[model samples]
Target chain A: MAPRIDTPGAAAQAVDQIQQLRTRISRLQESTPPSMPLETHPALAGLVQLRAGAAYSVDSATLALALLAGPSRSGGWCAAVGVADFGAEAAAALGVDLGRTVLVPDPGDQWLEVTAALVDVAAVVLVRTTGRVAPQAAEKLAARLRKRGAALVAWGEWPRCEVRLTTREPSWRGVGQGDGHLSSRRLVVEAHRGSAPPRRGALWLPGEDQTYRPERAVPVAAPVEGVA
Target chain B: MVVWCPDWPVVAALADEGLPSHLPAAVFHANLVQSGNAAARSFGVRRGMRRRDAQSRCPELKVYRATPERDSRTFETVLAAVEEQHPGVAPLRPGLAALRSPRRVRGGETAAAALLAERLVELGVWDPRLGVADELFTAEQAARQASSQDCRVIAPGESVPFLRELPVESIDDAADGGDAVSLLRRLGLRTLGELADLPAAAVRDRFGPRVAWVHRVVGGAGAVPLSTRTPPPELARHVDFEPPLDNAETITFSARQTADRVVAGLAAQQLVCTEVRIDAYVEGSDDVVSSRHWLHPRWFTAADLVDRLHWQLQGGFKAGEVRAPVSRVLFTPVTVVPDAVHADGLWGGTDERVQRGIARVQGMLGHEAVVQPVLQGGRAPRERQALVPWGEKPTGLRPAAHPWPGSIPPPAPSRVLATPWPAEVVGTGGRPVSVDARGAVLGEPARFRPEPGDWMPVAAWAGPWPVEELWWEPGGRRVARFQVVGVDGRAWLMTWESPGTWWTEAAYD
Candidate 1:
């Protein structure tokens, strides 16, 4: 037995039911504290996408500052914990709003407590630990970050991070044997997420023009034999 | 009724310096004498005399800088004493105050004035004078004429004739700039009687409005009413322990109620305190053993106050541990503003939840541990940045707008070492490189070691950029700086001193 020809009214009613069911499925997906947009530097747009309620581990201080600059420029508060050697001017130059930034230079034995407190308020928190973090402490902080909808950028090793960024093959320009000053630097940034193959991108982590952007390919010189 | 204390500035300055009142003293503002004591006046040092001339007149004179704050602060006690007798007292200036004529008191006006004078004597006012009249101007004039610790009462309707005989200089007290008095004297009007005798229209046309007003007052035609002042409400709170508490936790627990009361008191007044001064007194001591002023980015809550008390008792960075058991603790609001000024916007302002969170961390660590970074003008990376304790307003920062010459061109270092690490830079043949007196590099730096062991050849290097800072001061520094990049591609800012020592100051990581 087969169904007869459908009327216009029945077709519209079917579309409405399908729409309602789709919305319900989306709501169910959102029950796990849906991820929100976290600003990432334009130079790293394709290389990485920072999401709220996630922890990202970084190898260098400059990388941490670069990640902090994104949210800070968009008018969000940021904090740094146990970063005794924080370079405030450099952060400012990278577009981080110093007015909205706070620092706990030395938390001593209370680093975890201090970082957790700051995480409750700031949109992004950068932490530099003196020693390896315990797995239990990291898990506890991860849950808090998820609950608060804040992102974490660890300057050192962090357990089970969403993404790990490390700088490699750094080459500085604008200096000679003893003449010019140290100016710009070009580095290969490798982004690793879970077990996925690591993505590599070349960037002028501040090019000679004092802007962070993807490095353009240098035109290869014509072969000597072909030119002759 | 008006009460006047003569040479109050000199008196207050001497008392503050713990100097003898009988000794000659003068308060100077802008190098000119603002006030002089009796002893200084006897030495020919008068008001408006240059500080040099006053010093020459009396070699042993105690000189003090004029501070209006000191004068007003010391005068607060006197005002309180006067208010005890008469509630609505008007303070005219640092040295003068007025109140409504207390004519129908237990005793007449004279008896009331005598009682006030007696109270002033206890507060160490050597010469306090009082006067009573129907109007404020006349009362002030009469007070100046009264003898030490005495009252001059002008009978009703006798203000005109009583004021007529006084010198034109009497009007100098009313004219803040003293221009009218000088003009009156230059015009040969010697006394209030002569000035009063002149036609009102002519005084207005030639001598100006101020002189005309003086003329009207002297003729008893214009009588200005006094504006009495209301007493300020008490906002300070204190808690005393039955048995002195040595444990910080117990002391904080005891002070919880007082902290709540302090916040509730401000809330009742429709105000919020932004700065509070906390004083902790130890057992068997009258003076405060630990005193600190705590500031808040926003208004303080009761819990915030209690946290501050605990941190103070637990020994903050500047305030070391409380030496003895705490007997009492006091909280005084240093700065407050209307609550309406800080009302949250319709869309809300900076997150209040964030403030609470940061404050929680401040409670965990000491207050100084949380800091806000600020940039200021300087040559070195470390000097260019300042770390202000969280919640404190940054003050006395060097202006960054001014072009600081000799500062390294931007692409600033990423990591500025909190403490410079000892490094070594060697030239060819592994000899330490040094800078000459003229800032010339004696030999080119070839190899460098940022830490103790590992040595790497320099990939690129520049400078011996010399800086001579505060050369005239005893704690001056004279050093040459260099930017060196190692083979590993990590750049470091290094300093070279005279003794062939190299130190790494920062890293361009």
Candidate 2:
């Protein structure tokens, strides 16, 4: 039998101990990564939640940069592997901290090793594979990523990913036939997860003000069909 | 004591050109004679004479460009020779050096000077002169008065008298004393004795600080004590292979100890090396077969140095198949700073874990393969970004804040192609779209092929934003940029070169 003291200090101490135990128990469960509030771009906030120890794939370079900018803006280190055509100015303009970004433009045949090594340090890593990665290599990298509690954003197809983001129905706002320059773009971003219906949202990839934000309630017109 | 080798620039230049010392040679800078050798001086060539005038005076004068670096590099041997005789040698210039008079030598100051002269003569400095006196200024003047390979000794108490008898023009040797020397000459003070007789305060008020200081020194107030330079410690280390190791792995494995020694030596002095020069000497070569300078973002440790050695060896040899067996490998610390500059902050700096991880990756790929992205100002997307290799500082980057007039507007392209892809754009009648020399659009682009065969109709388009870059120089380009959006919703940055060639520079995916 436990003896409880009728004191305010004892009651508070008991509460603290219970909270500590709960956290410990949560940590002990290794099946899934504990969800933490990862800083996501406001334009992608409600559509999908970025969790630690997960792999996310994006079809467009802008979306990859957006995902990377979330962790980088919050003062986390980021790395890009095998992305020879990474546009640094665009990344910086989109709020990615260039100072904390390490880039391996061409990893040659060692892309997997390089990405795995970077995962141990950087909060988020974006990789562009030269060819389709083997299943075993992907599985191995996933385990390492979970253990290190870092996220991976693949620029191309991956064997298995927690979320897959693709940009569709893109339209330029201020461009016309030999007139004004490209000012902004409106794109519909779809996030697909396993067995669940994909989440769709409309956003200005870069609004005319150079800030990314969700589009208003106005419906976008159908894309103009092109001659194939 | 002062050791003076006159006309050092001309001497060093002639030696570098492999010309005989007896030939008339003059070192010129900005078309004016900076220094002339004795042979040129005898032919009426003087410092500050125009190149044409000097050539006219002596048709055979060998005019070589003046390089302070060459002069100093040649003087290093002379300095080392003097330092071998006496430890505290202060180099005043390329040709002049000062040292404390060695009064304790067997033949006193004169004998010590003679000993140094003999050493300089061995180094091909045929006319090295030495002087001993009570102060540095007097000693330097005395050295000038001394004959070739000789010594001039001004007895301790006789410095004042010795300086007084010198001409007022002698003051010009002091830095920024030219105007004062001229003023004194204009005032009819031909000898330093006349200048020294003036009241100290009057000279101080009239001739400025330099002349005032000279007056005080000439008035028998002793000059400041010599601030002797401490000799640099020997931090370079080398390892020699037994029987000349042909295998790269064996060479680096053996060099591990030398690398450790180099780092430890630096640590002993509470310093760290940021730049190191590694040289591998092949068995049959008199010079280094492979030499490269490796820079570290922070300071290097022993392990980093070994990795650099391994990489250097591997890079110099194709697939580790050495062309010539490596006999010796040397490690030289090119740049070192105190460890305090790199000490960890209270909350620690960049995560050491990240540094280690990046280093491991650098081991897998070459160092240049790992880079840090940086933004810079330019008109083109490719020019706006710079990739600095990992563990090296970015240099010569254009500032981004400056307004670039012809630059593309914001909403920069996402994927800046490493190399521009050749492309084709056609108008309504299958005519190739082009931009004329005056930046006029030849035809409205309707369909484009960004790749080899994939054609897409242009959904929206803008520009022929014309830019004439580096037009006055060779290889200059006259390009007109265009922003074209395809039906697939991908936008491309295309440039139309004169005479109808199109290239896709970047894509907004």
Candidate 3:
């Protein structure tokens, strides 16, 4: 013998509350879908985020391969556009899936159109710019990129890019005089962003084992006098 | 059952060139007469005659190059015409197709053939013949005997007697048909009956599987049913703009829906488009404004189709050229491959998001910008690396599996210089390091200078591995290779040829 409320208005009010509850439950479930784990290397730990709709500019193809290696190994599609002379074997040895990779060695003046089309499928696109891009064209391309959630790894300058990375003072190892083949290389990667303090890290572009690894300790160069 | 169009190659050639059948015509393959029209045959221009002999027989013989493409293209229409009369037409070859006896199509086999003949005549084929029998082999023989515009049918169970007197060459096996018949004749087996009468086991032992199969086929013991060819799927996907859009963005926006439809059509057939042919018609005109081919690295998805459409439309008009407003855009998948061949790998190839990202980038940049590396054969490291467009298989590349002569052994250099850096290698007496013709080091190498740097003293050096390439041709190359280790514990690969100068071709790292 709870309170007896037998009116059409009361019934309608109860139905409304139930409908409201159902909508709330659906919204909660929709907003909280399970998130996927991001695939990134320790060398580029915070510099580039996987699945983040952002453009990154890098100086060296070695670092570009290093950055793409993580996504490629984790079952992500990577493409190189207009970078005809990119070192593909190094990329393959770095664990990028050669089968999953696409290379457009040369795409002359119609680069912008090509890049926009590429974002429709490839997860990461590495493009080497040969000419300047109009501001309007860049804006349109960037907008589409953000909408599609595709990452751009520009070899040269890009308009309003999110991250700019550069590699300097690369030293080759495993060669003596005219003997032995080049086995590894060491480089320092510095990342800069708007108003953010630049971050620096040492990397083995391709270490002795032909893989991108964080440099354990910087090697000391012998003094010039000691070279005798 | 067999549907044979007499002198199809000649007929096809004549039709393609708009030549009247009243004129003598011959189609030659490899300079040997393949097919001759009735007019040419009347002039003693027979099949298997050399081109010169045929021309001697009929000086006015319209000599047309034997183009298989034109013949096949014309034959497709014939296939379609026959297909209209009956479904599941199994094309045996150009101008030849077969189907199961459609007993009820127009009352009986003869009636069906007559109907097909009537339809083919309507399609400009003058003399199409049809043959029906209990099995395919006898039916083909029956068709060969039928004259122009005629249909023949051998009653079931009567093929054995009918085939008994036929020549042994009637047993047609693609690989060794002619040779087997010749061999049978040499063995004194002249007729199909004589060849069929031989012991099956004995014939199989003597002639092999192909001839044995042919023997069984001629004896009416083996009957292979006609395998109906699946008709190619229709692939034209089009969109018409109501206002005849001039802006690239607007045109592409409308194209997205059409692209989805095209992809859906392909998916329904369990196929994927590898290449697309697009034809855009101008507003208020029937003429096609632009026609182009677009290749894809992977199977085209809806988004990929849209991107390609957008790219093509934007680049359709060249600089300083008057642009045409696109009234209708038609996308046809010119080439399709089975989906089973391109299904995703065990570890889903690439993330869907990643694929879209790369595709978007390619659209903005251009088609040739993105590339994937493929291993190829060559003596040098640079030559070994080949780039293929993403999603496309590498083709026409030197096989990497072959053992290339004079190629450097494995643990190959990690880095290769695009252009070899010229360097100096001096011996103890300061003479340039050289390799003699006998592949011997001229002198003990002392110091190596790479780009005027501090001369690093060579701690140890390997032999001069000589390479002589293209020796039979002019401008051949002869070079000697050496692996040198410096006092600083670094290694480099150096090469020297005639007029010796050590060039640093690659580094260990």
Candidate 4:
């Protein structure tokens, strides 16, 4: 029984927040920790350092895909923000506990609820908004997410939430064992934070039978000893 | 007359299908609380049938008032008593029950049957019957005869005598007025035991060989074995708070403690609830104030459950007012599935991986808070979105980006600019912001500059897009908005010359 924070006319409420409102958020960043960058879990390290009382936003699907690749427990603690029901297919695909994942009904103040929910969830998968939010609502919600140690991710457009990740549709080529269907897909992604250069790699969806495998770092050319 | 349980497992499955709980005398339910009309229709009550429908189904079709608590209590008791006797009871329905036992024992099963009958009577069941048969099919039939406080024991070999006397109608009633009875009646078979009197060949010749089998069953002949099942776990305890708790705090505390106990029970088996239902009622308010607490699958913590109670009792819910002090509290796991997760493998597999993933969410969004829009039922696009429990998955993942062709186009701001700001849009670049005959205006306007902001010089912008909405009403399509981006690194979708001035449309995010 959460406090029923009815964001009455949240769209209208947030509409007032249009762009003038400013937001102050302390970010949770993934650092190398003076050790091996390879051994470091960037997503996890960054997640734990998140400030508890702030509000922020991120990409929902991207976060989920990243989580699927990284270490995580099941019971679907991750939440997708939207008014519609995301069933077993998506939950299973995301590899979270289907039971634990929640669907927030679409209330007018999607921004406000997204903001409010930010404080409670580790990550909020916002179905990228097609409609515009009141600038103030966006600021207040972002401010709140920053304080709450929660993260908001916009699924379609990353910058809208001020945070983002990039993953393109994977192309697969293979038939899966189940029902003789093709399950292979190939995907390429480049994840970047703030202004960091994107971490690039190829992802292979091994026909549903095998787990997703990411290719190792694409090497950057280092100038040879004598070469200018 | 199969009344749907509606306990998550039941209610969510009604897919524009026919109602199951209907037949008057048997269990009928359009919903858990009983759809008497649905029941009436089945009992010869047709469409447009009224109260007279009740009598048509079955005069004695006992309308057992349903309270989820009562159904649960009855189920618990039924399961308990069945387990107590044979140590093997598999639950069937909320208000109904079943138990399994082995057959063909060197020592006759009569002893087991007698023991079960005695226990059922002792456990507050009215009249109990003990049945001993090689087949479960016969055992169920034997129990049917034992319903009237009379101990009717149908031994394995003596089923002929036991079933021969019972009318075909009895078998139909026992099956909740389902199939077998009607099929048998159509074949002209009057009693269960009469099959024993018929010749196998003759029975088969008339009923396509299936009759021979029925004849054998009716004659109580053949060696049928039983498939025994394990009994359900028994974890019941009673507690009476000394001072009746009349306030929400007291009730919440009790609920919290109760939640601990519930969690402990599940944890012992390494399980967590996908759903937990909390039943709370005031001590003296038994007649009026009783509330049911529904938690989303994400509300797994003790705090979560307690918070749910606090929110409900302190206010007026659909169930009405919390008028009385709730003296008793019943916490049941409406659903407790298991959580079998493999540990993280070489690649940060399990929990660690999850934390990282969550961190990414929190890092960007700013916090760990997650919620969902819960309320639906709206006609407007903005009105349709409702915030619900965080961590919940979205039902419909609507495509996030779309080009509003007829209206102001994007590369628009992700945010809807605030309105009623008291502004003036003095320039429209000589393109009157009006809807044309073909509903098309040549590139509405390429740009604009705000009052407070510096004048926009460069024009790397697009659109004087025209939009008309709700054309039915006079002046319905109120604002003819446009998309304008200034060369000064700023972009906006502003409604030029509307009810008020310069209402900024959107930002590029």
Write down the TM-score of model 3's second chain. 0.64
Model 2, span A1-228: residue lDDT tens = 885869999999988999999999988775345354467766777666667778899999999999999999888899999899999988998889998999998888888999999998898999999678898999999888877778899998988998899888998889888888899999999999887999788999899898988887433442322321
> For model 1, how does the per-residue alpha-carbon lDDT over B1-509 read when each residue is reduced to its tens digit?
99999899998898787777899999999999989998999999988999899999999999899998999998999999999989999999998999999988878999999999999998888789998998888998899899989999999999999999999988775435288788789889899999999999998897777778879999888877778888998999999997898888899999999999999999999999999999999888899888898887777889889988888888832355576778999999999999998888898576778778888888788777889999998988999999998877787899998887778877889899889999999999988898887878888889999867889999999886788788899978778889999989888899886657789998898
For model 3, residues A108-187, the per-residue Cα lDDT tens digits are: 67677777777666667778887775778778877766665667788878878777888766666655444554556677
Query: Which 10-residue window in model 1 chain B sums to the lowest lDDT?
Result: B316-325
TM-score of 3: 0.59
TM-score, predicted candidate 4 vs. hidden true structure? 0.48
Question: In angstroms, how far off is B114's CA in candidate 3?
Answer: 5.6
The candidate that achieves the highest DockQ relative to the unseen native structure: 2
In the predicted model 2, the residue pairs found to clash are: none
The value of fnat for model 2 is 0.89
Off by over 4 Å in 4: A1-228, B1-81, B90-147, B154-156, B160-194, B197-202, B208-210, B218-220, B227-257, B278-280, B286-335, B342-396, B399-481, B495-505
Evaluated at residue A210, the lDDT of candidate 3 is 65
lDDT of each: 0.87, 0.88, 0.75, 0.44
TM for chain B in all models? 0.75, 0.76, 0.64, 0.56
What's the best-to-worst order under DockQ? 2, 1, 3, 4
lDDT of 4 at B492: 41
Query: Candidate 1 on A118-196: residue-level lDDT in tens?
Result: 8889989999998899999999998888777788999989999988999998888887877788779999999998899
True contacts kept of 4: 0.06
i-RMSD per candidate, Å = 0.9, 0.7, 5.2, 16.0
RMSD of candidate 2 to the true fold?
A: 7.3
Models sorted by lDDT, best on top: 2, 1, 3, 4
